[model samples]
Every structure is written in structure tokens, then in C-alpha cells.
Target: MYPRVILKETLYKKSQQKRRTSPCNYKERIFMLNTQDLTYFEHRPRKRPTQKGCIELSHIKCVEIVRSDAPIPCDYKYPFQIAHDSYYLYVFAPDNDCRLKWVRALKEATQCNNLFMKYHPNFWGEGKWRCCHQTDKLATGCSEYYPNGAKPLPPTPDPKCRFLDLEERIVVALRNFHPEEDTDLPLHKDEEYVVVDSSEPNWWTVRDKNGNVGSVPCIYVAEKISNDIEKFEWYNKDMTRTEAEELLMRENKDGGFMVRDSRHAGVYTVSIFTRASCIYRSDGEKYPLVKHYQIKETEGENIKYYLAEKYVFSSIPELIRYHQHNSAGLITRLRHCVSRNVQNSSRIKELSSEKWEIHPDELILSEELGSGQFGLVWKGYWHEQQVAVKTVREGFMSEEEFKEEAHIMMKLSHTKLVQLYGVVTQRSPMYLVFEFMENGCLTDFLRDKKGCLSQEVLQGMCLDVSEGMAYLESSNFIHRDLAARNCLVSNDHVVKISDFGMTRFVLDDQYTSSYGTKFPVRWSSPEVIRFGKYSSKSDVWSFGVFMWEVYSEGRVPYDNRSNSEVVEALNAKLRLLLRPRLCPQSVYDLMQWSWKEKPEDRPSFALLLHKLACLHQDP
Candidate 1:
């Protein structure tokens, strides 16, 4: 393969040496790309081409279309660059298609080489970079560089070791999903399956337990290492330390035990209730203490576990069997295994394929919670759990319209954002099921609490909303209707961002509204109110006013001002709301930072979250 030709073309070329002192004149050249090397020859009229330079393909680190605005003194103006061995060679083509063809072919030819993770899109010219204006020639690229320009394939499984690595290779379904198309495979919650191919980021080809193979969404399943214990009576996988203690205390039974996942990932702890009848508190009540023991694992060829080093068992069940008959080193022998579902508050699987789109007949409505811009909000029940239902008022929006909102809502999941359980779109008057917020909307909660709220509480609300907004920003979602009225308050006073009325998932972080698209004028950034431009940073501007609402005890921004007046005020590039009375200067400064005139000047939601978190640590 030494001299096998891959591509042969005549093109205009610039100096191969990247140094500022190198020759700058453009000249015609005959370029030949072979399996082993790329060789360019000096153009000679009706004579043998004289070889000018040769570069091994292995030396090529980058091949891409260069972003440039320099005057081209050649017939071909479409330029692409090849970065090899600390130097760049610019080759000009007659058209963009020709430039892209060379760039793509070169990229494919060098796909397997060790490559750079970052690159400057603009040309590094005149002893400076055009993209970021860095003086250093070897400075890190201002943009992310994706090697191979494609999703990586999962390592192929070796036939001999496939079954031997079952625990690590097999993924168990977290929820049920019926096939929506020919490509999709039906998934049953908790069933294990083997991944056949994971070349697609969201969808993976998998083989189920019954040998049924098909494509499934990668998010629907996860690898569960110790799946054998999932069906055990004593296992409760999703409870916290406090939750375990509460469960054991409620039972009021000594020696009652439950094995739960530890706070530290991939670890387990055993909690047991042991009581001393004579040990009484000063208030004359018997004391109950739940002893927690971390199950220690020993490193060896075969993994083993034990509460005490002396009595080790290969499995947790075996250890439970031993401790059941004898105390050994425990405070008491394990007895009366506590189940998770005894109380209705047990953890519900967050998302599953079958749970997202609910049948309207299954929802049970009781009392009216409230009403909003979309429709009437009602307290509803589904799967025996209380949820808030937001109905789409007839004529307000159709099933197709509501489905777009639901699709965006389903992809998002964060503690601070109001959780969307599912939707009912198959019938008339489509509705959405969301986690109920007992304390109601944030605006109402702020008004009701007013002077009774502490500084910590106000700050906590800001942090919670910022955290949710940060998640949305990272997820490339812009909550165009972000406001205090749109946020909800949980029973524990946890503030969660809600009402994604104008939400859009943008890959490029920018979205333009249609001619008649509606948005909150009072809370929108300048670009949005004027040009109808929206981005995550635009959402940050809305959050500044949201923070103002919390600090001002729910006072509306530009009180008594009309929507047109608010737009005019934003157009004038002035603050719409002043600092709240008794608000911290540092916090007020951050609010102003979020309300910058340009969206790019405003901080990201992630950065806002950091600033608020830092303020949380403030006195």
C-alpha cells in the first residue's frame, strides 16, 4: 500500500510552514494523496512534476475547513487547512462543495489517529488567532473538537467472555415501553437485557432475556450489577438513612432489619432496630436506636461480604440466614424483614416507557387546585398517587400543540423543576400530570409568608429555582416563561420551577419566535422583547426578576406598568425593578448581572447557580 493513490487533484496552495516568517505567496500545485503519505509537487508546464514536499498521513493531527476572511489572490477561493506536525497547509478549492469534499475525505482517512480535543475554527494568522485573539500560536482551541465527528461504538463483546461478564454487560429495564415503531422493542420494567449495539446515543440495540432483539431507548435501561437481590424480601433499594430509621421506628419491632443502598454509590448498608426495654428517656419514653452496619467486602478472586470479619458469606442472603439464627457480632439477630411499600410514600420509579402517556379514564379528580393561563389545575390521582393535573382548555391548544409541550417536558428531570409524570393526549381536552406542590405557586407562597420569611428561606428559594434553571440551561432548554408565578412550592417549602408554556429545546442555544408567538413581555430579555430572539441566557434575565419577586415578598416587577411600557423600558436598556428593601447588596448585584442588556453578557444558569450557592454559605 506504499504508493496506492487515494486522491489526485490540482489546487492553489499557501506556505506549508506556519511561522510568520514563512513565504506568504499563493502558488498552483499538483497534490496527490496516497495510502502512506500526502505529496505535493511544483506545477511544471508539459514536463515532469518536481516533488516539493511529502508528509506522512500519520503526522496529520487535524483536517478541517478554516474560518477565514483574508483576501485570496488565487483562482480558488474556498480554503481548507491540514494541520500536521505543528504547521498548517492551506489549500484553496474552486467552490465550497469542493472544499467540503476534500475536508471530509481527509477526515475519514485520518479517523483512527491520536487527535486534538480542541481547535481554532478561524485561521491562526499574523502572529495572532482570529477566533479568540490569543497571541500564543499553540494556545488551546476556543472551540470543542469532536474526533471522528460521530458517536463512538460500544466495544464489541467477545464470544468466549460474553456470559462470563454478564453482571457488567447486561442492562435491566427501569420501566415498561411498548413499541411505537418497527425499530422499537417492547420493554418490561425490571427485566434484564444484553446490549447488542450502542452506536446511537439515545437508542441502543439490545437482546432481551427471552432472546427477543430490537432497538430501545438507552435511557430506559441501566446496568444493575447485583440484580439477584432485587427480588429479595429484605431489600429496599431507594430509601435514605432517615427513611430507613423512620420505617423501622414505625414498626416498633426489635431486631427488624432492612438492607438498603448506601449514600456512597455502589455500596450497601444493613439497618437493624434493637431496643432496650429498661433504657428510658427523661420524658419517660423507651429509647429506640437503629444500628446501621456497612456490609464490608473483601478483595479476592471471588468477592465475599460480612458484617464481621470472622463470619463471612458469599451473598447477603447467606449472611442474613446466619444472623437470623444467631446474633454473631450484631446487636440482635435479623428478624421481621421490613418491606418498602408498607407506607404509600415509597419511592416511585422516576420514569418508565408505559407511564409517560396515561389513559384519561385512569385519572381521578377531586377538588380544584387552581387555574392558570393554560387551563384549570385540579388535584388528581393516578396509580394511587396524588398528582396535579393541568388540562388544556378547549380551543386554547389542540392535541398536536399540547404534544410539543409534553415532548419537551418529558426529556427534563431535576429535583428543583416540577416533575412531569405523563400526559393524556389521545382524547379530547388533553391534560398533563405533574408532581403536586402542596404549598402552591411561588408567588402566592411569597405573599402569604411575607414578613414571616427569614433571609435563609428567601435565599433557599433563589438557589432552588436557579438549580432547576441551571439544569434546563445545561439541557439546552429555554424556559421562555420563567417567572415567580410559574414556579411551584412543595409541601416542605422546596421551590420548583414550573409551567414550561414557552419552552423550546434548542441544539444551538438560540431560538426565534414565530410572528404571533406569545411571551411574557415583563420578564423577557431585550433581544426577546425586540427581535424575538431567545436563549438560555435570556432565561437568566427572567430569573433575575424571579429572584426580585422572592426578595420583594411577591411584588410584581414595574408594578402597575403596562406590557408596552415594560417593553419600552427594556428597549431603553434600563432596570425594570429596583432593589428590594432590606435585600443584601451582593444579592442585588447578582440580580443586576443577570439582567444585562446583551444575552451573551449575562451569566449562564450554571454560573448563576454557583454564585447563589456561594451566597448560601454567606452569613
Candidate 2:
């Protein structure tokens, strides 16, 4: 606590003046704070409360020595050294026990590892200073010392301090991850497409906003270049050679013309006037710019424009249509002969300067929120809005596969499901931009409370979950993977489902030969486990198990039994033994209704929703 440091104007007494070393260098004494002074302040009593303060004492320490070889080098001992008026506090303790103790404290106070103690005049005086753990939230030099200088500051204000808010904002961008917005691709004008670049599987050379070069997923790139191109052709097959020449003359009044062999395919190979002259179009009709250049004999390679060769199967009318399609600039035909491997490596090793565009602040990584198997999710700001960015390991998936998955997710819109705001598929591991959930997953909360969710609360949760499933079922969607971890609970106990990565579009055929069980095996319906098929009814079966989880206070279902035991019990059609203390007959009745053998016999989600709702009404 800072005491009233009213610097009173009093002539120095004889003893105090004598102790001050009179005629000392006008260079003011740099009152270096030491360990003893820090300890004394902690134990001292004062007239007025210290203003969250610390004190420093000078000229009491041992003389400074330059040790050439004192068995340990200073630099080696201190990777980060503090030089505050010659009194250094090594933030990193060298000993294992002490270091671990300090590390734990720092992790609790602030997760950031790059903690730098700064001197702010308002918080600390000219010479004396105190500890303020730097955090990503507050600005640098913002003191962590509490208003009362309490040893351990009170927990950060919640629900903001719920680690989930920070964790949810992290997103990882992988190679081949593309910006879904603001870039043009070859798609219909009305179609929504993410900006994607097919770069190397591992495009390491990255240049961030600060011009600092580092290795990162290609999806982090904000912008890239689009090369415009066009081809030319003529289609009037009925016209005589003279008539064709006349038509060519009329069209070529502007600038360029060229032509080549049109002898093989049904359509003739011809050239005409275009953007740069040598645009190729399937030949038959006269090109407008043909008159720009006189026709002359040219070698194979020397031919600037080569049109399709005319053949018996080729129709002249079709060739005319092809010419128009090329002319419209709406179609861009990519040739297989053009090697992406060769061009990507030799021509543009890194992204072009012109192609580089700014990503919404959210797209740009701010700080490493955390790391996981997929990759790292960084906390970032997009358009001044907060978002979590998940970047995945490079080459984890194909670009096409990632894009297909993203397409499915983007098309889906449900309040019960977590929304997919943006996606990048140009990178190897794909990125999903989602609205950050303030409350952490229900799993964390359950684990924290020793899995002791009250019976009433657990029943209410069951209703929320069923309602969410009802919505999904109405949309003809199956979560495909539903578990306690996937179910998110807000601080206020509202349940919402998330993580549709494994979700698939349910078709009329209903059954898939892909997996024996489309849903999680542990929570799977008996039919799913035995016959390898799942429908909305199967989801109801899983919901029954999820209810068991909540009712049991999150005790692992069938935990004490082996996999074989579970399989055997289910095969014998055994009902799960519910804890009577926690679950009432109503709970048992609802679960039994859902866990019926046949899908047709099982109650619909709407019916289940009604029964669960009635439970709440009963209370």
C-alpha cells in the first residue's frame, strides 16, 4: 500500500545532512531498491497508507565487481536481467524448486511469458519501484499491484476471466488456408467463394504486418494477385473464304491479328484481334482483328495463335458457341500442360507483393492463445472485433477436401449450432472462424465441480440438449458426433451444441457403408454399434447417454467395465443401472423411451422435447 509521500520542505538536520554525503555529485542519487528494502517495506507500519508503493535504499549494498571467471557467467545465469539502478532482480530463478514456485505464481497472475517490469512515474517514484506482472489484457507499464498492494490480487472479473473466452478466440491458419472473403476466384458472380491460393503444401516463408519474416501456414496471407486473360475465336463456318476475309477485315480495324494450324479437329485453327493479339479461338469464322496482320506461312512454334483443328465429329455451330464463351471473359479454361509445380516453385516462391492484401485484424494473429494437436489457435482482432483463429498443421488435409467441408459448414445456419463466420482453405490444415463463446465448454465446468450437477439442473440441461437436437433433426442434419465435450454450457447454464467437424448431410438413403457407427461408439445407439447405421433416432439414443452423463454428475459411462463388457451388456439388451439417488422415475422413463431397440419405436425428438419440458413444468 502506498503511504502519503508528502515531500515536506525541511532543512536537512545535522545528522541527516551528514549521512547524505554533502557535496556529492549533483547527479541525483539513484536510490537502488534492494532485496532487504523490499522485505522491510512489506513488514513496515506507516502513518498513512502507501499509495500501492515500494521503497528503495541506496549506498548500502556491496561494491560492484566485474567477475571474469566466478565459475558462472552473469549472462548465462540471466538470459533476462533487470538493471534498475544497479539492483537487478532476475525474474527467472536459477534453482529448480524456487524457479518452479515463481513460475506457478506468474502463470496464475498472468499467462504471458514475456513479462517485463517497467517504471511508471505514477505507480512508482523516481528511484523506487514495485512488481507489476505484465499481461496481454492491460497495457505495458500498467501496474499489476492491487490498489491495496495485496500480496495476491483478487481474481479477474468474470465471466470475462473464464479462460474459455481467451481460448475460444484462438484460431489456427494452415497452408492452403485461403481468405473466404474479398478475393476473386473463378466462380459465378453471385456465388460466394473464399479467396484461395494453391501454394506449396508447406509455404513457410511468411511476411507479417511488421515486415517480419517467419514461417507460418499459407492461410495467414491476406491478399494475392489475379492475372486477367482472354482468348479469341471465330465461328461463321457457312461463309466462303472471301466472305470470311471480308468479315475479318471488318473486325480487325483496331490493332492485332495472328493464326496457326486448324487442319485436324472439326473446327479450324484461326487467329483474330484480341487484347494482346495472339488470343486463340476454335477456327471457322473470321476474327475481327484478323486484318491487323497479313496471313503468312509460319513454323509450328512461331505460330502465335493456334485454333482447334477441324474434324468430322466437330460441328461448326458448336465452334461458334465456343468462340462466344471465350469472348465473354466469364470462362477461364486452365490447361493441364501448365505445371503448377514448376510455376509455383520457380516463378513465385513467395506471394507476390501486389497480391498481398490486408486481412481483417481477426485474420492476423495477435497472440498465441494456446496450442493443440491440430495446430495453434491465436487470439486476434478482425475489423476491431475479437475472434479466435485456429491454424492447423501444414499438409494435414488436401485443399479440395478442406474447401468441400467448409462449403457444407458455410451453408448451414442454426441457432442451436455454433456459426461458422469465415474459413480459409488455401493452407494445408484448414481454419474455421467462429464467433467466440464466452462460456467455456460444459466439460470444464463439470470437471471443476467434481461432476456434481444437481438433479434439477441436470434435467433442465437434458431439455436444452434435446431442443437443440430437435432443431438439427428438423433441418435434416445429424451431429454425427455428440458428446459431453461437444455440448457447450454458458455461465448461466444455457446449453448449446458445437463442433460440427464430423457432421454430415443426411440423405434420403439414410444409411452409409462408411463407418460401422456414424456416431461416437461410447454413446452410440445399439443399432449403430451392431448394424453400423444411424439416423435422427440414433441421435436420440446418444442423447439418452448424454442424459446419463449429466445425471451421474459426469461419471464416465460404463467406466468400470471393459469394452467387451459394454458390448456384451448392449448385445443382451441390458438397461443401464441408474443411480436412484440422482435420477427419478421420470428420468428413467424418458431414457427408456429413447433407448428402444428399433428406430421406429423410439420417440421423435419433438416428443422427447415435450416430455423433458413437462419435467421442468412439474418442478
Candidate 3:
């Protein structure tokens, strides 16, 4: 039969390889839909196309959206599975719109096929089922078809519109809108609305599909393409399972392995070595070997992993790192050979260097700048220059911890970031010398210049911080404690991100806090507060709060609430009030963009800087 091409597009196909623990490796492919078959090529055509794979339309059993429970990359925005017989093919589209189009077209093309009664939600790629973690790769564990499986009938003519009505309508909920006057609509996250009017620049009048009509800030509605996959540069790279496992194993020696959890969707638990012993015996064995422990999910959304269950961590790596310091139990004493192997590794030596150490006499302490839990910051003289010296308390931080911080500080130097000069380790109280800011912290500066400073000045301050954060993001650094208090203002009103105390140098840009680590609750993102997970996106969340502080002239966020109260409010999805009069609508929109609940939904600092520059340029 002569084939009729129905649709064609550039899409990514999940490779059939299980080298690393990660689910699948996505490769760029050109997919084409035809009346007779669904085929894909290795690349775009020029002279002749090399066929990668194809499936006969008659063999197609089912096609449906991959649920959130599937073991797939968080960056894979539009995932779907196509099952034929017992096997499945997992594919990813660039956006939701593209994915929907493909799904609709495929359903129409294969309407007459004799399909299977059930379909697996996950793809059986390579030699195993990545989602179910089943070793029998060919086994069809379970399947269910979508209720709306049949091809859609032609649309009925609308009496109101002779022409096809194509005005864009979006379903979204208000994230941070508070009604001030009687006419303003009090918007909440639960209420969904359809945009009826968006002609006015930054404000839109929406009719709640459920029958309420009111005007709301355009930024309050969540964008439909929040997790657009094209935003990531590494979305097209393909890696084998072996490469992933090798990388994970090379990074650390603490026996890390990923396993799918049956109860949770899109969640996996990683097992790591723990120092604590298992006191409880299993299967008539007393004092059983407790070499490893699985990361456990705690109450609410918090996750912790430990053998003693006393210390909880947000991620597996955090738990492993913590045990390296507090190695007190039978496991540590027994695993001498393994510990020696890790210690002798070149990575550990490179991280423990003392090149940053400075002479005690080089720094002359003057007046104290500020004091905190770690120690004090002093306005000091170092090498004939004014410097801010941070002195570590005698009992607060360990030697290893200090070295880690110093090592990280030495590698980073940016104009918008407070530059670390050197460290004084010979003295009783160790000192970290940094570039001094004449105007002190941003909080006090903003509070002092309230009403006097123009909106352009405030916008300039945000741009400065965003530039610094973009640098940090590029360097794979996460400033967990990003806030107005942690930022310093130069004499010329340029803001520099300071207080690298909570900063982490991460490979994947994700850092999980160890148990009992104190984080500023008010400025923290939802993930940081709930799961103790810190990333550049979490820093973006804090940046939103910081922007709010700038616009409100440094007023305390959630001022009337206690730390516990703020946590409760955050859990209930309440956000800071919009400063309508003080801040421009455009600036408020940027702030709301940063506060998206899903970390991936938030804009990167690079994107944020661009948006701010565009807003500043606008008259």
C-alpha cells in the first residue's frame, strides 16, 4: 500500500541502554508518522536518510501519557509510551503542545488496529524495565488504557464564530494575588480560571470556568509551558547505563545504588553506607551487618537517611558526607580498608589542600561588624587594605569543615560576589579575609534609602544580584542562604552576594542539607523548607523573597508570623503580599516567576538577568 505522510517533527527517542542507574538516555531523532507505519531516522535528511527504527501500524497496541510515577528524567517534560504486543517505546516531545499533537495524530492513524487490552506505562528498553526495576525485561507487569482512547470526531460548528475561534485560552490558578479593594478579586491557588481578557499589558480579567469573574495580575497565573524541556542544553545527550554507574561509583565509595520505590511515582531511593549499627536482628540473627541504609522518607515531604535514624538528610549524598565526619559506630571501625581507599583517592587530597592558609600576623582585627552562630565578622586591616574578616568560633566548626569552605571560596571570584582574599589558620580563632563593602548589608541600605531611592536604583540592585547568581549558577554553586541580609551594598549602590557560609559546590547543582542544619525559614523555597534540598532553583526562590524585601524597603517577610507560623503558612501555599504601589507590575511578575513551586518551573538566574535587563530598558 502507498504510504501517506500524516505528520513529521524532530523529537527525542529514549535509547535502549541500561549502563547507569539513571532511567534512559535521550538521543535526537527525526520521527515521521505515515498511514502504514511510524518510522524514525538517525538524523535529518540531506541526500538519503538512515532508518533507525519503525513500527507497523497494525502492531500498535496502545498509546498514553506516561504518569509521574515512571522513572524518567525530571527534564523530560512531555513523556509518552507506545506499546505494541508486550514491548514499549518511550518517547519525549519538546513541549506539551507538540506532545498532544503527536498523540492525537497517532490515535487517528491507528484507529482500526487490533490492539492489546492492556499497556505498560513504562518502556522496556535495553534489557530491563526501568520503571518497575524488573530483571525479566520481557515481562509485561501491568497495563491500563486511557478512557479517551478513540479518535476524536470532527468539531461541531460554533454559532458564535464562523471562523475557527483560536484565541489562546489557558487554565491556571493565581499564585500570589491579594485583593485590596472591593472590586479586586481575592485570588487563591485552588481557584482555576480562563483568561477572558489579556489585552491590558500586565493585568488580565479572567472568568473562573466555575463562574467567578474578576481582574487579576497577569503574573499571578502560572504559565502553561512551565517545564518546557527545550530550556536544558543537555536534553539531547545519550549516556549508557555503564557510564552513569561508573560516574556515580567514581564520585564516592559508599556503596550507592538506585532502586525504584513501588509506592511512589517518579521517585527512587538510593542506598548508601552508614556508620551506625543495626541493633535489631532479622531472621534470628543478632547484631546483623548494617553496612548500608536506604534513604527514608520522613513525615510530610521531608526525606532523611541514616542508620541510627537520629540524623536525617535530604539526599543520599548528604547522608554519606555526614557519616564521613561523625564515623562513630561498628561499621566505620570495620570498614577500615574501604575508608583507606576513599581517603587515599586523589579527589579527597585535592579538596584538602592548605594553599589558602595565611599568617595570623597579616590580619589586624579592628571593630566587630557582626556576630552569628558560627562566629564574628570584623572590620579589619589585612596587608595594608581594609577587609571584612570572618572569625570562626573555637568550638563551632571542625578543621575539615573550615578547609572545605576555604577551598570553595578560593576558586570563586566575581565582581558581584564578595571576593575572599585568604584565610588565617595559625591563630586561635581562624579568620577569613574578604573584600570590604562600604555600605554594609543590603537590608539596612534599602531600609535607610526608602522613598528616596528611585525604582531604577532598586531594579539596578536586583540586576547586580542576579548577575552574581548567574555567575554562581554557571560555576555550579548553590548559595543556600541567599537573601537581602546575605547581600552587601557597595558605596555606589552595587549589590554583591555575600555570606558563602551556606554555599555548596555541587556536580549536579543539587545539595542536600545534613540533619539539624539551620536555614532561614522565611526566605527558603518550599523544597528547602520541606525536604532540605538546595539547588540554584531554590536560590531563585530566595531571590524572589529578596526582591520583595527590596521593593518593600527591606520590611521583614511575613513580619507578623513566627518561624513556625511561616512554615505553616508556606505549607498552606500562602505567599507574600504584592506591593502594588511600591513596585512596578513587571518587577512583581519577575518575583512571581522565581517563586514557582516546582523547582524546574522557576527561571534560571541567566534568564532572570535577561528579563530584568529588558524590564529596566522599558520606559
lDDT of 1 at 540: 91
Which candidate gets the maximum TM-score versus the true structure? 3
Residue pairs clashing in model 1 are none
lDDT of each: 0.74, 0.44, 0.65
Q: Cα lDDT of model 3 overall? A: 0.65
Candidate 1, residues 1-619, lDDT tens digits: the string is 2578888898888774533211235668888888788899997789999998888889988887765433343467678878788877888887766776777778888888877777886777646776666998788786555555542233343454232223336777767877633335789986778978654334567887787777786667755555367776678988899999999898776677889999898889999987742257899887878889998889988788899897776667666655654455677666557767543222122222334778778999988988877799999899899999998787565333365577667666556778898987666567789999999988998899889998878988898888778767766678888899999998878899888866765546777663334587878888887867788988899899888888999998988788888877777887845689847888899999999887779998767776776677553
Tell how far residue 414 is off in model 3, in angstroms: 1.0
lDDT, candidate 1, residue 113?
A: 84
User: Which candidate should be chosen as best, given lDDT against the real structure?
Assistant: 1
lDDT of 3 by residue, 1-619 (tens): 6888998988877655433212225666789999888999877456576799999878887776654322233244577767765556777887766777787788777767876565555555424554454668566555444434541222232344223225656645535466532224557674566666554323456666666666675545643323222232211123333443444345343322222222344333322333233345467654322232334556775444454566655444444444443332213411111221232211223232444566777788889888854799899897889999988886466545566577667666555788888887666577788899999989988888878988888888887888788878866679889889889998778799888766776645777764344699999989989977889999999999999998888899999999999999988888886563578988998889988889999999877876776666562
Candidate 2 lDDT over residue span 247-353, tens digit each: 44543322212222233433243334332233455875433333222222234543322233321112232233233222212111110111111221121112212
- The model with the greater lDDT, 2 or 3, is 3
Decide which is better by TM-score, 1 or 3: 3
Provide the lowest-lDDT 10-residue window in model 3: 333-342
Q: Which stretches of candidate 1 lie over 4 Å from their true place?
A: 1-354
